[model samples]
Target: MTEAVFRETTADPRTQSVPLSHLSLELGHLYMEDFAAGPERLRRHFDEVRIWVEAARASAARRTGGKRPRISTCFLIDDYFTRFSTPAELVPLILKEAEEAGLVIDYLARESGCAVADRIELAESVMHRLVESPPPGSHGSRPPVSRTGWLANGQRTPTTRNALAEVTVWQPPQETAARNHSVFMDVELWSEKDGRRQWSCPFLAAVWQLARLGLLRHLGEPVLTPRPWDGEDFPHDWDRLPPLLRLNDSATPFSAYRTCTLVPNRFVAVEDAVRLILDQTDVDSGALRQVAERSAGEGAAVPAAVAQRATYVFYEEPIDSSLSEGT
Candidate 1:
């Protein structure tokens, strides 16, 4: 009788590796309401975004020492919290507006994919990895943030007290990394209805950034790898579309060393919360190492901190636009 020796090796496919671009530039995000308003809505948004996109590209070129940086553009549509139109009717319109603005969307993704990409419970997995940031006066004990579904920049002030309890002064929340003055923020991570759980927009958005940064993995395997779209007709249903779709055949890879999102001013606070989540969430070390090694091999300097790798440009929304929370 013989026994085979089990040894862990790097050759295992579980350690999924993805191609990386120098930058993943997000032109804008789409919502049902945004698109339903009309193509003019998409046009105005992209028209304003076109100039900023050039700025972002120029910035990336400088970072690469005047080299032609490999940049890929992506757009995300909100399909999880609220589904409005199918891919067939929505994608072409989005592409048309981007083209008119002299923009190219190399990749497109669905918001719900952040929650469950390719059948993987990505949001839940990220939730488990969240480690609350310790504020100035943090002790060994902390709040149950995952259960409570709330995350704050600093310790929260107690809002309730019994009459029998001793009187005390009100404590204002402080930002962990605040300067002389405090700019505190508290974000709700998710909500529950009946037995099902719904992830918040910021939380899903954070996951989306991680995926674009190539920092996510499922049991050592990459999640949400882009599916190629060869100009074939898009599906009538959202589920039929892949979590990530590569629209341009000549475009660079989906994942990148850094990401820059050019979104409406309305999403600035949401992106801030996303950065908060990234600062606290612990990503897979192996995946992080892979990104670093590959980037260095190409003589690029990727930021060490995952949270700092993402940047955003807050552009003014059109005067006629009405921004909604779900978007």
Candidate 2:
């Protein structure tokens, strides 16, 4: 029998004519967290949204032969966290619920200002402010306790900043000693110091609190239960992830031709949500097949074809609190 012939085509040109976005899926979003997290967090999220938009814009541009396209994005979030009684407790609950639901939270670097801070000094300054002041109008008191020399600066007041950022203080039902209901705070910022190389301490503490309290883990499950992580799923199972090629459609009209598809393998379970990012390449298929054929007899496996980037979508219902309703 004659050798199989393969035909390859480059990225689709139509992508330039359409709009694309990298779907910012908010699985279990806490609204109070959004408002209480302060402008820096909000700004970070906004910046992240723009980055995805720009990436898609670049992809569309290339598909249409350098036609830069106007790309728009839809932010999808599952407002499941609203059911939790305490807004402050929502984060862990949301994370756990997401884990059980098999959803992956892509902590896009663009969404968090903390992700941008590279130095401990920057982290400490930002965290100090977050923990002390919070956002505006959220807390009833001022920055509670200031240990660092940062307060020496006259620019910020402890009380005013505390009042603005405090979202809520929860009092739990189980009472012990003088404490009755646990007081929950809405937004909290934490940072690492220069001497201590532990920038992740804050995040870890938050996660541990959630995990220990069984907030994210099911209430019935042991508090020590491990939360689901991205590495647990497919593609991640492979010893190595294929090199990622980020392409942008630089043209305005936009086309669907530039994209890549993520295939599942022994290491990872192919996820439907991730499939939206594939792009069609302009390389010749015959050339690709010939290469594959040449490599096969020598023990190389025939490589699977690559798909273009596809669009991802996520949606979350808005919180209905009296505070948020007005917003």
TM-scores of the models, in the order given: 0.90, 0.21
Scored by Cα lDDT, where does model 2 land? 0.28
Candidate 1: tens digits of C-alpha lDDT, residues 61-154: 9888899999999999999978987899999999998998999999999998999988899999999999888877577465678778998888
- The deviation in Å at residue 221 for candidate 2 is 41
Query: lDDT scores for all predictions?
Result: 0.89, 0.28
Taking every candidate in turn, the Cα RMSD to the unseen true structure, in Å, is: 4.3, 22.9
Which candidate has the highest lDDT of all?
Answer: 1
The digit string of per-residue lDDT tens for model 2 on 1-327 reads 899967554443221111222121222222445645443443334433333444545654554457443332111121222221232243334334434444333321111222222222323333332223233333444344233322111113232234676755442222111244332222222333676444342332222212211122121222221112333222321112111111112312111112221111210211221121111112233333433453343333222532222332222222334457656
Runs in model 1 deviating more than 4 A are 1-14, 139-142, 159-165, 321-327
lDDT of 1 at 39: 87
Per-residue error at 90 for model 2, in Å? 16
* Candidate 2 positional error at 224, Å: 38
